[model samples]
Target: MYRYTDFDAAFVAERNAQFRAQVERRIDGSLTEDEFKPLRLMNGLYLQLHAYMLRVAIPYGTLSSAQMRQLAYIAERWDKGYGHFTTRQNIQFNWPQLRDVPDMLDALAEVQMHAIQTSGNTIRNVTADHFAGAAADEIADPRPVAELIRQWSTDHPEFQFLPRKFKIAVTGSPNDRAVTKAHDIGLRMVRNDAGEPGFEVIVGGGLGRTPMIGKVVRDFLPEADLLPYLEAVVSVWNLLGRRDNKYKSRIKITVHEHGIDDIRARVEERFALLRPAFIGVDQQLFAQIKPDFAPPAFKDRDTAPFDQAYSNDPVFRSWADTNLSAHRAPGHAIAQISLKAHGATPGDATADQMRVMADLAERYGYDELRISHEQNVVLPHVHKADLPAIHAALKAAGLATANIGKISDIIACPGMDYCALATARSIPIAQEIATRFDQLKLEHEVGDLKIKISGCINACGHHHVGHIGILGLDRAGVENYQITLGGDHTETAAIGQRTGPGFSADEIVPAIERIVDTYLSERDSADEAFIDTFRRVGMTPFKTALYGESDKKQKAA
Candidate 1:
């Protein structure tokens, strides 16, 4: 909820004006497609399979009602009537005309939002835990630090064109809902034994063709040194990160090739030089931003109506049990609005639904909303008293899906449908699995399963960290789906292990069912979650379930 200052407003306005002129030049043939590629990417515009895709940054996944309304307007007025909320805590307008992009950017600017740094080789959107300020377990709101990174990285001269695209994420809670370990620089807000809040910096972690968990670079960094230390980390990478091979150019690769200790030493050397340049300016900004993030004035109210609704409506009870999280306030709860309605496209919210969410936020959620990395919208501070009303509105708008962490709550990238780099379709695979689970009525029974699908190894769906990871590939022009078991996107982050053989598109869903069936059979009880069971039994039983003993022996052979 950080409002733009005059300088911030002017900066965005200037960037928009420049981009608008650049777009006009491209349209007029002054700039060819090849000439315009980098320019367009710099402004978060990409030419996808069918049309221009504009990714707009929802910084740290925080949005006000007004901003939400603006996005709805953009979706309705320029592109298709829906926007795809991505796993990176950003939204993608998949069918925008190149001519309409400048107007879209201008509209976004009016609401303190923009497409800047949403794409390209520069630091992309800085993300944080969706439950940043409202989560009960948080040590501090990580958004302040995320915002600080946003300010520091935006149009930073040194990082304009790094070795490759960089991503950063922060999480306030020890639960690690933000998938911090999968980012270029992962900052976990923590306090030392002395009780001073700071960051637990992790580097080298990423999920792609090669998945590796990030290593702890600094055990505990003081709050004051965050920006400088981050600069040092990136500075070291910029100087030594591979440039010849695009596939090997990420900071994660750099950290992997060179040991963490060497990288840490280099970062410290750079930190000594950059520390003075910050000179208290970033902390001053942090102080200015902190006041805006003060917790909402929560009302003290009875939960009688909520209890009545829960008892009277089984639908409401199911949704509340699955989608709601405990809040720090006595009467408030965090409401996660599922974008993944059964068989529908995951993360694709219709304009009307967006408008409904905006209205609900304004009326019942302290005018705030958050986009979860799992492709759901979160009303972070909804009072228990408002749950019934909010649920009713969401149900009417087709935004109410009871599945939260269930098998149907899938994370899928916009694969062959929209992405040019994809070899196979991911959306249909996710749809098939979700629809299959829904038909079987097995989601609740399965319990707390994460199914992430990627069209390719780029891992935009974060398949590597999924409890059940599916990677889609093109094997001899045939769509082949590979499964990885035991991946976790939490404090205990680990890369999933690949199971035996890839399944055909038609075979993938049933393969997943077998895996789930295996889990259910192997679990101590239903109380044990899918992930817990997987970790307990390891991958053998699941592999045996998916590929059988003969197939496993054949694969091993």
Candidate 2:
């Protein structure tokens, strides 16, 4: 919850003004579509298959009630009546009129938010663990470092136009809720032997046509040397990364082409040269930013209401069991509000739903909200006493789906429905899967599953990291969905392994069902999760379940 300073306000105002003029020129025929492409992209505008899409950054996925309200207002006023929360913890307005974009930008600026660096080949929004400040196991909050990186990367002269887009994710907890290993630069906070908090830096991890887990470049980077070390990493990659081919332009590919050891050596060399200039300036800025994220003044109260509801109401109990995470403070919980209600779009929230969440945050959640990378809204610090009322409000708003980490709680992208680059539709596939599982009443039975879907090989939906990953492709002229098993997004991150062949769109849901049924039958006990079963048994059983035993035997032979 970093408040915008006068300088921050002025900077955003100036950028908005500049973009407003740029948008005006494009509308007036002063610039052609091709001519204005990069200009619009720089401002987080995309001309999708049908209309313009505007992506607004939510730095470290933190938002105030006022900011959330303004986002709801923008969604209702300019675009459709809803906004899509993305895997990067940003929101996308999918159907904005070209002329209204500047107005939307201006409205976002009013709340100290913007869409800058959300697109194009520069560093995208710096993301962190959604439970950064509230996670019970965190060494320290990662948002201060995330915000510092955001400030340093925004419009940086040297990095404005890198060979490809870059992403950085930080997690304060060792459990890695932020999927740090899949980012260009992943910072996992850790305490050294001397008890000093530092970062374990991972580099070269990315998912697209080529998916690779990031390598540990720096086992332990001191907090003070973070900025300089980060600069050195990016600088080395900027020079070494491919510009000739966009496919190989990412730093991950660069890291792959050059060994991690060589890359580390180069980064260290660059760090030696760059470290002198920083001289603790970044640390000073970080110190100033850190206070803004101080823990909210939590009220100590009896949890009698929550206890009563949990004991009496099965509905409330189910929601609480699924949606709540342990908080750092006593008598507090982190409540995850599901956007993926059964049969609904995975990451979309209606304006009304947004307002309800904003109200709940303001009234019961210490006036703060967080957007998790899993496409859920989080009240990072809510008293357990308020669970019943909060659950009631969410139920009324169609947000109380007790499916967090369940089979129905999927992560998917707006595939062929909106994205121009998509090959097949992701929304319908996700909806069908969720609805199918819900109708069968097997979500709770399935337990702690992640099913991620992508429209194409771009992996925008992060299918590479899901326990059951679905990648929708256009096979010749038909929509074919491929499945990957055993992928994990936690501390032991691994790219999913694909099962043989692809299923028709009609066969995809049933295929998923077969996979789940296989897990249930093969697991040693009910306590074993789908991921654990997949890992323990390996792909042999799942492959036989997906493809036939004949095909499994064929592969073995």
- Give the Cα-based TM-score of candidate 2 against the true structure: 0.99
Model number with the top lDDT: 2
- Give the 10-residue window scoring lowest on summed lDDT in candidate 2: 547-556
- Per-residue alpha-carbon lDDT of model 1 for 1-557, expressed as tens digits? 79999999999999999999999999999999999999989899999888889999999999999999999999999987999999889999999999999999999999999989888889999999999999999898899888989999999999999998999999999999999898888999899999999899999888888888999999999999999999999999999999999899988889888989899999999999999998898899989988878888999999988999999999999999999999989999999999999999999999999999999999999999999999999999998988999999999998889999989899999999999999899999999999999999988988899999999989999999999999999999999999998899999998999997899998998899899888889999979988888888888888788877887677689
**lDDT to native, each model:** 0.93, 0.94
What does candidate 2's lDDT look like per residue over 1-557, in tens digits? 79888988898889888988988899899989999999989999998999999999999999999999999999999988999999999999999998999899999989999999999999999999999899999999999999999999999999998999999999999999999999999999999999999999999999999999999999999999999999999999999999999999988999999999999999999999999999787888998999998999989999999999999999999999999999999999999999999999999999999999999999999999999999999999999999999999999999999999999889999999999999999999999999998899988987899999999999999999999999999989999999999899999999999998999999999999999999999999999988888888889888888888798568679
Stretches off by above 4 angstroms in model 1 are 552-557
TM-score of each: 0.99, 0.99
At residue 306, give the lDDT of candidate 1.
97
Can you list the residue pairs that collide in candidate 2? none
The reply for model 2, stretches above 4 Å from the true place, is none
